[model samples]
Target: MARPKLQDVAARAGVSVTTVSRVLNNRGYLSDELRARVNAAIAELGYRPDGIARSLIGRKSGLVGVIVPSVADPFFGELVAAIENTLADRGYKALLCDCQENAEREGEYLELLQANRVDGIITSTHNRGVSGYERAELPIVAVDRRIAPGVPMVRGDNRAGGLLATRHLLARGSRAPIMITATDHAGNDRATAYREVLESEGLTPRVHAYGYATPIDERRAMVETWLSGRRRLRPARRLPPRRGGAAG
Candidate 1:
């Protein structure tokens, strides 16, 4: 069956199309009796307004785009969930896009979001330059990664956290603490903090940087090699025996 329209509701309500439109939009003052009649007619006809038509008329899509590296990652999954909940509270819908750590795919998703007339975008991936983002002409919030100069960003204090972690290890009698991380990461603030804390304590900081995009086997081999080298430099020390027995 054909769905009911505004004209059908107007005819059923015994009112002009203008009156029906005004009632639907709540534009002008309306008599209680007239409003009741229009609402009753709409209810009787089971009429539902077309969201796309309304969005086109209002020039707002009521959509917010969210682009992440990959939803498979727990961090990105949690981030997307938070964004979705916030958007839902604000009466906006989320258009989620996973770039899968591909720069070209990320750029394409950005264009797709733009073409869809999304009101804004929240991105956690910034592999490409700023030009792609600039062309979107929409409000953007960068997550963890800095984009263009004008773009706003939200990130944790990684450097402070790193410093705290290193200090804690040092206090616990960790003579040679090392940091392992991706080599091509956009920022090295954490590594800098780790180095600074180690240098302040008159200890050399050891860092092992690996390619994040490499195959799992290759990464495992690299890590194993680094660990073997470290073991050769400083063998594991035997702990003192406990009062009751040897410590497990």
Candidate 2:
């Protein structure tokens, strides 16, 4: 079946093609009832505007490329959700690319997004040394990590967060607090802050680097070893322990 076109929408709504175009572009004076009729017909027909043609004419794709390491991670899930919602609120669409923190895949996605002519890019990938972003000629912003030398970054105060977390654990009677973080550069500041806060309290700080490629079983064994050979914890077998008190 042929896809519905603007003429079909105009025919369905009993309006001129120019009038439909005006309504779509929000040009000229239009009645609320007439706009409702056009929209109702569009919804009934399930007709969508041709993004390519619109982009060619308007010089804007109305789309933004959003690249992330993994949406399955809780932090990333919330971040992507917020990004998509904010893009929709601004009348733009999100083209999400999940690279699973792989450098090659992230490079490919950068090329793909540029080829798609996305109006802008918002990336949270932890893949380092990928130079595709540096050469891109479009607007690019990073969240929580650096993509290139001059890229603007939007991140939280990791130092304050690390201090607050360490102090909280200490207050709760945690004698031994270890930070098991990924090898991402974004996490380096937190570890530094952790060491600083612990040293301030005359406590030793233990920071272990757990890369993303670590297998589940290997990670479990490593955690067990870190926790002073304690029997593996249940339910959270796959996660690292954040705080512990004298192995008790």
Candidate 3:
């Protein structure tokens, strides 16, 4: 048999389709009597609102969009994979959007996700400027980044990590140690914390923000170069080799 439509439910309830829609959307001011009648009619007809149909009417898609700056980075690749797996387990599918660090492309992706009726979004560009992300009306969760207002955030303490790195360098008796970091909107937070701790101990902090490659080995090589440069900057002011010190 053909399934009942919302109009059928509304007619059975002696109400208008608008009223039925209001009841379904939880919109409008409905009296208790009308609300009960609508629900009872819905139960009697065994009618279910077609999510796809409603999305068409409401201009929404029942998809979740996930935007990552770059999936080539192992950290983001692993994070996206885990999120996708979890969502799949729960019977939800995800739309992966890779922006490749292009702000214009990121904005376009957000628009595209919305136009496709995405119910929600997850973003890893929280560490960067998020004005485009903030404009989206869908429920957004920032993974490894935070920018949208009232959105749930999931990540580690960047400031604390910076402090730990600074102290570790200082403990190694490297007074003029330099920090190598990526150039991002959030990168300064760690560098700021690093500076505060070093300045407190009457030491200067050097920060290098360039040449950050995605591959782990390349990143390690870049870090090594930064460390070597720091050593040359202050070959005389050195601390003894740290062996499980307080900072370590």
Q: Superposing all C-alpha atoms, what RMSD in Å does each candidate have to the true structure? A: 8.5, 7.2, 8.9
Output the number of the lDDT-best candidate: 2
Writing each residue's lDDT as its tens digit, candidate 1 over 37-56 gives 99999999999988768767
* Residue pairs in clash, model 1: none
Better of 2 and 3 by TM-score: 2
* CA error at residue 135 for candidate 3, angstroms: 3.7
* Tens digit per residue, CA lDDT, model 3, 61-134: 55789988777777778888998898888767889998877777778888888877888898876334546665
Ten-residue stretch with the least lDDT total in model 3: 239-248
Give the range where candidate 1 is weakest over 10 consecutive residues by summed lDDT.
Answer: 239-248
Model 2, 84-114: lDDT tens digits are 9999999999999988779999999999999
- True lDDT of residue 149, candidate 1: 80
- In order of appearance, the predictions have TM-scores of 0.70, 0.73, 0.63
What would the TM-score be for candidate 2 when compared with the true structure?
0.73
Better candidate number, 1 or 3, judged by TM-score = 1
